[model samples]
Target chain A: MAYELQYYPGATSVAENRRKHMSGKVEKLRDISDEDLTLVLGHRAPGSDYPSTHPPLAEMGEPECSMRELVEPTPGAKAGDRIRYVQFADSMYNAPATPYFRSYNAAICFRGVDPGTLSGRQVVEARERDMEEVAKFQIETEMTCPALAGLRGATVHGHSLRLPEDGVMFDMLDRCRKEGDVIIMHKDQVGRPIDKKVNLGKPMSEEEAAKRTTIYRVDNVSFRDDPEVIEWVHRVFDQRTKYGFKPE
Target chain B: MVNSSDTNSSDTSFLQLEVSPSRLLKPETAQALLNEIVELEGIIRLFVHGPGLPQTVPYGPAKGEPVHHPANTLIEVGGQTMELAVYVGGIRLEVADADVKEQVREVCERVLPVPFEFREGHFIPTRQTVTDYAKRGPGADPVMIGMTDPKGKLKDHPVCILKSESKGND
Candidate 1:
């Protein structure tokens, strides 16, 4: 019989959202220009050549390794690209993609990706060009809420802070500001002011965010309310304990 | 002849109106609320506290540049001009009795557009503290005890005493 894979098991919306994100089934919501994405990332200039660390793999001539012959190299790896990183700070207040979920999505959806999940922020490091492609997916998909998630390389203190009167997450660096309805980024991720502002489209309404969020809060969809998830957690815990002590 | 000790004997209470998960109230709303609340009788001292708005960008590439927060500006309260440094998060009042507390609540309901709760407690230090003596030096004015910002230099007095001007327009 052909094997079928399951993402997550639960009937609740929060669990469903987790499954969708893990399976990369979320619909693309917005499109950010390559120039804007590069500017916000602050890694290199929009039109500048990606600085390579070594000669291209094609020119270098590969050593006799069976594993290297079996697996195909990524585009950046072929070009001997330098590894770069992009970090996102997701708000705890029902942001669509939390740190853990972001890492899960990257692990399942992309290859040659290194995802690190922190308490307030998540980082993905890959070859420069590859990282930009991943960042574009993250920014343009339902994975990010413009007001709730921030592209901050440092000073990621606003994840748990209360939203400002304007409803956007608090950012001491003031990298982004709301103009009428849309959020605009006026600075790079590292807080250096940029020459032009990148318009990030309108933020989702409270109702939409609540519906799309993967977080389980008592105020929203509580984790305890999902019996399937609770049972699965218990089963995993029991199996770990049972197998840890005595092996068959 | 009255004894000198009798002058110090009196009951006083403080009232605090705090906006939990502090929000930045508009400058106009803050001004209007202050004007109405300060006019009530039995309210002796009024102080507003919240997140400070620095005059300049403290760090990053924009260091030393002026921070243009709309809430951080000069406001007229009870005809007295005062500069607001912080977003109005809480208002502490030295009220004479419970009756004045009720009056303040009425004013809050009519003026404040955000959520707020009032509690009766000693919100400010009534007596001189050790820091006051250490920071202000000896012979510091008793009136400036809990009023001044400790982080601010001696020249920058944060305390403002509101006064009514007979000819001033509202």
Candidate 2:
């Protein structure tokens, strides 16, 4: 705790943006109401009570444990809310946040959260209310560009694929549509039609995306350009490979 | 857009015009590109390829729902209206020779909105492969040799523009 923790090391904007994400310092880009976010999440109906997996922690007396006494349960856990998840698929073309960075941000910023990262998508699981909060923050922040990043619970196939001519990320489900300059979400994460369309504001231009993105693309800021990050990565890789095996 | 009267025996060289940024082309742009290139000289056959846009959602929770993609629309190419099923990433043309390839490149530079690579190699196979022989059998037309997918039905792959000498293989 004494020494300052460095989230990432590089001289480029991409690296700086990555550090900003990990440090939970992302700029809030849009204002999405809680109701709109809840509808997009599709876990429960808006204004409905969060379903519970167990009774409230206070009602059901806990067993005497030193760890339980020292560690405080999150509000969602204390209220016995059911576990729920929010998943995202980001495009490879200068999207603000990629799968790994999404996971890193979630791990650093949120509590009682389980973040899963894949090649194309990132999923964060928490108690229903807790996940709603996390999803809302992610949706309303600069971390997500409506055109390049999408909320997709399943069939998240567009990350590595090409963007359409209009520059919107390809979604097989067609969950979001580009109307004029803004991107609108007509369907929930699982591809079910929602009652009201959610306006996700205007998508970032190529110049803006290149400046804000955390991804190190060859066209934008290539990974090879940052020698400090490369050296650190190679050091880790070398150590892991050399010492990975035990004495024969 | 196929001319039924044209036989494709003499079509030897292949050229592919790959759109840069590797994105799917909208119907309007695809139609424009097709209309421009199909009128050029020495082009025997033309084929468009990219990831498919299925009519119905192919997988996941909304599998049966209509895709309603903007790209999946009827496009008129070479005065013939046909359903465009895939995002036209690259337009492969079977030209008469190398000179025709250069002509095609010039036309592409003029018509294409985005940057493209005018590749001069065999982008698509001209001769029938063993898989095609096994799946399509010997009775298959020589022209349809490598143009049509062996597994996919002909109805599925509807974008075939065949220009003959009498009309416009310009």
DockQ of each: 0.20, 0.52
> Going through the candidates in order, what is the number of backbone clashes in each?
0, 1
How would you class the docking of model 2?
Answer: medium
RMSD each, Å: 5.3, 3.9
Which candidate number maximizes DockQ?
2
Candidate 2 residues A1-248, lDDT tens each? 59877899999898899999998899999999988899898988998998899999999999999999999999899999999999999999999999998899889998999999999999999998888888888888999999999999977888887788889998867889999889999988888888999999999999999999999888889999999999999999999999997888
lDDT of 1 by residue, A1-248 (tens): 99877899899999999998998899899989999999999888888999999999999999999999999998889999999999999888889999999999998998888999999999999998888888999899999989999998766767886566677776666678889999999888867777799988889888989999999999999999999999999999999998899655
Candidate 2 true-interface contact recovery? 0.61
Candidate 2 lDDT over residue span B21-121, tens digit each? 25667788888878877777666667787777777877667677777777788988777788887777777767776777777777777777677766655
Question: Which structure among the candidates has the greatest TM-score?
Answer: 2
Please list all clashing residue pairs in model 1, or write none if there are none: none
Evaluate residue A93 in candidate 1 and report its C-alpha lDDT on the 0 to 100 scale: 81
lDDT of 1 by residue, B1-170 (tens): 22323222133334434333244466687888888987887776667876666666666445665545556789998777989877665777667677888888888888877666777776656555566666756656444556666677767765665642321111
Alpha-carbon lDDT, every model = 0.78, 0.81
DockQ of candidate 2, scored on C-alphas against the true complex (2 decimals): 0.52
Candidate 2 C-alpha error for residue B23, in Å: 3.7
